[model samples]
Target: MKSHYKFLGTFLGLLVFNSFTLASFSAWIDPYNVINSRTLPKFNQLKPQSNDDARRFKAINVTRIKPKTIVLGTSRADIGIDPEHPVLSAHAPAYNLSIPAGDMYEAMRYFQHALVNQPDLKQVVLGIDLVAFEHREDVGKLDPEQAARLETTSYVQHLPSLVFSTDTLTSSFSTLTANLKGEPVREYYLSNGRLIRFNPPEMPIEAVFGLHLKSAYFESWYKDFQLSQQQMDAFRTIVETCEQQGIDLKVFISPAHVTQWEALRTSGLWSTFEDWKREVVNITPVWDFSGYNSITTEPLTEEMHNYLESSHYVKEVGDLVLNRVFRHELRTVPNDFGTRITTANVDAHLAKIRADRSKWVRRNADVVQLVEQWSRE
Candidate 1:
């Protein structure tokens, strides 16, 4: 009986010791950066893999940075918008609060989250995407659990996972291994919350565009895409809050490659797309950049780097956006790139885009054919 009792005591001690060791390792490595307690150069500083729970890290980032200006939107803004643009930086310190495939609710909620942390917020640059407003009944809604997590993510709230989760321990070990290998960070977010990808994607742009059309457009997002009044209301809340707070707010339709617009038209939702713009202008005037333009018509090639794919533009185009919106010193904006649209001018603006679309279709029938073929597939 004494020997059996001694064995039980030793087993309990070993189990506790193992748990403590793992917790300490995960906390120190801080793989997801939720803890951020212990980080070192060549060991854990460059977090090569994260964003699995982006809502948590991003919320913590906003809390810690307390930026005075913020950029908000979907992945279009996430991968495109530069928080450090000369115009933005001159105005105030900015952080990109956009999320990948972000919905209007997250945009509104995160705006509130930023305001909670930085009451002195001075300016806002918001990118409103057409797809994010979709009802998603034909596809599916955002995960309810993930949506809940976005609401309460902070350092304290993340402590348990930061310490004891087996998944976190695995991530910590992977991070350590990657650091020791001295691999350059392929993709990660900057301190200002801007996303960075060190290398251009190796896949050819045409192939990538096809993947987007077939995988993303066909399989999701564009299927029976219908707008939600509830989401539009949430967007209204963000706009109203900014107005009440006296923040200088600039809203724009994020530019996509011409092929993207073609896909939207082919999906049989062109009228709905136009109506979305009208709805936005009703809420607040917006800078329209989604039509066919010099920037959007750039030839699709891996070497161009103007667009990462059909939807996500790069910093050069983003710079043009800042220039157009803020009237920056360089003034590098193309002649037909962006237009200010209010309720009065929206009808005419939509008409002009339709004319432009007709011209583009006649000129680039091959592109139109590709969109039509892919939509049927």
Candidate 2:
């Protein structure tokens, strides 16, 4: 009787253990369906390999990013600045860390993460836009599970166990296979020719015009050009934190389609933006490209084509913006000085800038013009 009771107890113990093990595994595996099984409509009918492969590869690459300056913004800024370009070499080693559809909130979170984990980080370039402050459905929706997996703690604590996991390896293989079958690749491609693919989505003029009018014009014009005190407080918090951390912060507005800008100006959003700009970073060079339409006498239609379609020139545009900031000698120690751009490094950077004058001017003509104009002032 005693022996039989012990056997029964052991059997039940094994059953409970197995159940708990399976349940824990299920939690991990279920989320993988979101990435691997194409459960979402946009991803549906895509092979399991597509989602898993890209993310796994991204995770590996992200582990390698030890940047001195991180460029944060939406897809427009991401595509505009190439980190590997020679122009950026004069600055600290830059990482084009912008994510697609990224906004100010997301940018703030990214900066927070970088500050906590990357001690070597020295500077940040935040591309600000009216659209960044506009309320959006997808703004704060970060995946908790993905966030956990990507956190600095995961890299330090469980990397070995994670690397050895059979499930992880299986998922990675599934992802690679989907990628090989031409599941839409993201930033980089390896097997095909080492060509950088430029696939900008077609932007409808009506949609652009409507967004401009709604966010830039209607919100600022009719609703009031006022940000709630809470929002202003948050912005101040970010600025203060950067100052405390000794990070060099550069804030600038990105260019938009001329028609969009005209609508925004007429709608009175431009005035609000200018007002907000004066308050945000008074001393820093604010490169407002919104006035490009007035500066260039080119036909509005032709200018729109040049602005919208010119990916190659977008790099030049980025250079132009940064150059304006540099030439104005807007370089100053933050009042709440935590980190200073090293003097030796700045002198070395200035030397490089002098050596690369033609390259800098061509790459950043918009910036160069502003600097020349400012020098005269």
Candidate 3:
């Protein structure tokens, strides 16, 4: 009996030592800065972790910073919109909360999280993705617990990473060793929530075309999925919540490249897209930037410079979007690039888009081959 008691005591001692060893490992990795840092690591030094996990981890930090202005969208805004831009910061200290594949439901949760932390919040700029407004039949394939986690999670809940979580141990070791060797870290996203994607020095036009052809966005747009009522309801709630909270809200449709615009028209979703714009404007005034304009137009023959691909425009275009919407000044935007959409003129504006696209198609007949080739694949 005495020997057995002594053995039990030794076993408990080993368990306690092992627990501390794990905790120490967790702190060593601290990739998200969730455990040991008072503020996030230097924005440039921070790399992208699992973006979904990164977004969840970053949500806690953003609330702590409590910036008065927030930009919410998918990866388009993630890479495109800069919170530090003078125009955006002029209104309020801004933070970009955009995430990859982030939908309205996810965005709304983040916005609400911000509201809880920022009592003095002033403005919100939402870059709406038409795809985000579509209902997902299979939402939880990746990170199946994301919805519940985001809604109810607090920073404290994630602190188990500092001790017992095996994920923390693995990630920490990887991040530490990678940093030492100057390897390209998966943590390409900064603490500010901007995703600086690593693009090759020279991406040829054919590669760009291949990327768009293979992208899920291309297939989804081709399917001509209509916006669901549930998505609209969530969007309306976000708008109304901002209004009630006295936050200045600005919503904008991102400018797609000519190839993408052509897809929308060819898929017969242009009318549906127009309807979405009209509905959005009716909810509140919005800056309409979709459709074929000087901004969307690209020479079919030459390698396009302004766009990263068919859907993702570069930072220059992002600046133009902010300038047009906030400054009401067309810095790089052609006079026809955007309009202040309202209920009265939305119908006429959409009519103009159809007419303009018709003319655009005539001018760029070469696009038919590109489209046909993409459709076949």
Candidate 4:
């Protein structure tokens, strides 16, 4: 009996030690940036796993910073918009709460989280994504993990999944191994809640654009794409919430390369895209940047100087976006780069876009042909 008691005691001790060990490992590696206890170089600072886990990391960040101003959208804004930009100072202490592949629902939840933390939230730069506005019936369900993190006040409630799961352990190992191997840093999450993504230096911009052009994500993105009522409702709520909260808001549509516009037309979603713009204008006056302009029509360069791909632009363009919307550095921004559209002028603005599209389509036959080929694939 004494020996049996001794064995049980030993087993319990080992079990407790093992649990502690696992949790410690998870926290140290911080695979998802949940327990950011120790972020040392060659160990865990740059998080490649983070792009997919953006919702959780971003949710945690808003809780920590409680920023008064924020930019909201998908990876477009995540990669481009600067929280530290001078134009956003009208509403001080801005945070870029944008996440990769984020839909309107996810964006609203994060915005709500920000509001919960900072009730006196001042100003906002809400970048709208046409792709995110589409509701895919195939992926109708919210991710359970992201849903739980957004639901809970105390993130500790979700620590078991983050700190004790086997998958997390795998991630921890992967992160450590990546550091040990000295892998190229693809992305880094800043303390100010902005995310920085790096394209491979060896790869030319055309290759990057081709990768995006051939990307299955974009191929599937416009599949049966229609404007989602739920997403539109969420967008409306975000705009209304700002009005009700006495928060100043600026809205802008993110710009895409001409190839993407041709692809949208090829997908037979051009009418729907135009309708989406009208719907957004109805909700609030917005800066329309997703059109054929000198900026968006920038030829594919040797490096990612202007646009990252057909969809995402670099931070320099984002700065130009801020300057245009916030009415700063007007000399730097071309006149046609961004147009402010309201109920009164939306029709004229869109008509002008159609005219411009005609000219752009004529000028870029090769790009149009490329988009056509990619769409057929």
Candidate 5:
């Protein structure tokens, strides 16, 4: 009887040990979605953080909550365009899937994932960044492991989130800490999936231009850039996929502020810019909005209300682009707002751009000085 009691005691001890082991693993691995199980009061609302890395957190969830229309691009599209805007929502339920500094490869990856998870997606509003097309090696080049992780099917890809992954746990903890302190959580996406500006500066046009002068980021925009074959292949795939799936695709270049144009001109990249427009026209017609135009020249009057900086434009310009593209509220496309580029007329269009750019360069001495400084550097 003592031997029997000893065996029973050992068995009970083992059972208790097993249970504890499993519980500890579960808390660490979090496979049952316990981390986000309880809603934090402050983080209930979708707040898009400005960091590009924050995109990974949103990418998987976007597939599950797929909207009919997806807006894809870099930061310009992230903060500039609102999918929930009335004009976009009127056409279809829309979501902005743009990422900060997102490239063509990332866009394709995200959209492809969305298509796989939600095949009913009907429209793709792609904001084609001109810089994305420069150089073959730079386009779509991700480490093999990272690429594999990014391309995993949505069903399995997001499973890690159900558990206590570092990214998810950190974000949750951060939100909790912020909530406890009554501080704003630095979030990156709205519930509607549009990027929110945490705090936009209210400055005159001169201050805005001065900000650009301090950063030489625009220099690369003008130097030794060329459209890549790989980029073209990726772009063609997106176009072909949209066509095959009966998805309405609207592609446009983002509206760069005039100072950006001046930089390009001063650096002798204007001709290259025209060449890019011509090449893009061959692949598919695009509404070119980058150069000398009323909207772009708005800074001259200190009344260019739609721009935040040389590279960033406000949502109002996005609205104008949408209106021009869809004709939702306007009978005619707004003048100098956007011009559709076609292969048939691209040469003529490019010539006119040259003339306009030269005329502007001659008149704007201050902008010329800024451009010359950038060029010299």
Candidate 6:
């Protein structure tokens, strides 16, 4: 009996030791595999991380990346400007520090985090949205914990090399795991020194029916959303800090479609919010494209007119807005002026396309077809 008891104890100890060894090996191997491997499998269980992750990691890696000008907003600004494009390259080093569905509160938090790591930050291009000013509850989704972690910790001082390395490892792990699991990773992954991803497809009017069905099935959760006043106060604190640090701040209200603008206007709350935005910062160069009502009136080419709502403009329109903001020469103008003028230009461009819609469709038929296929999938 004594001999048997000794053998059982020894076996159990060996089992526990082996388990710890395997867990440790996994921790090291996963990161190593991601950093070394060029191609990783796309897995459905993991949501694919974006190339933006890598770009951001690289930007942080720059030995002296105290960019004088940084762009801030949601995905609209993020996807609009191509970092490698010659126009942006010629300008002061700019980082598109934008995230999907980001709002003013989140932007402010991001600014705070960025400045903490980069003490020499001098200039900022802030993208404002009227909707962001309105009461919202979904703001909690902005990952405040991570932002707070960055705020409290002197990330640069402790792990100078670890800052870039941690970012790289995290991004690679997230992406590789996501690819292994078939998931809707945000479009835009690096391929052959360029970003590539499936484009949104053109949908027939019949597609609207499908959308309606989906909407009906999912209960609307908009009512539960409410913006916290405390968070707004936090943003104000960030602005104050920037001002104290002598950073030049340029605020921009990115363009949106007219239909969307009208919806906001009707919401009774939007007007009050607009007033709030004006009070906080200089309201010039508002990149409001929401006034372009023609695209909603009639569809142009499937490729050009593929957006389901005013919120999602085609890539062409996105580029046009970027070109005007970054490259166009203009006199010293107010924030609202940029939006008004750019809206007119966008309208004109759309009107010209509508004049010969068939010709435009033919010219972009291949792209349109690709878009259509993507939508179906």
Give the candidate number with the greatest TM-score: 4
- Between the candidate structures 1 and 6, which one is better when assessed by TM-score? 1
Cα lDDT for residue 230, candidate 2: 39
TM agreement with the true structure for every prediction: 0.87, 0.52, 0.84, 0.88, 0.79, 0.54
Residues 1-377, candidate 4: write the lDDT tens digits: 99999999999999999998987988888877666576888888776666556777788766666689999998889889999998887667788999788788878888887888788899888889888887766333677876666666665566766788887888888888888888787886665667788778888877777678667345578777778988998899899999999988888999878777877888888889888888888889999898889888888777447786888888999999999998898999988899889989988888888899899878778888877777666
Q: What is the C-alpha lDDT profile of model 2 across 1-377, one tens digit per residue?
A: 99999999999999888756654443233223321222323322223432333333233334444456677766556655556544455545566666555456666666666665577677777666665565545545667844654565333353444444566556545544554566554434221101123333455533333443455345443344443333344456667787888877776666544344444444456556555555454434444443333222123232243243311125544555555544423242121111122322433433342344444345556543432332233
Model 6 lDDT per residue over 35-134, tens place: 2123434522222344544333323322234444566666555655444444445445555666555566667766766676577777665656554543
Q: Is candidate 4 or candidate 6 better by lDDT?
A: 4
Report the Cα lDDT for candidate 2.
0.47
Ranking by TM-score: 4, 1, 3, 5, 6, 2
Instruction: Determine which window of 10 residues in candidate 5 has minimal summed lDDT.
Output: 29-38
Q: In terms of TM-score, which candidate is stronger, 1 or 4?
A: 4
Pairs of colliding residues, candidate 4: none
Question: What overall lDDT goes with each candidate model?
Answer: 0.82, 0.47, 0.71, 0.81, 0.67, 0.46
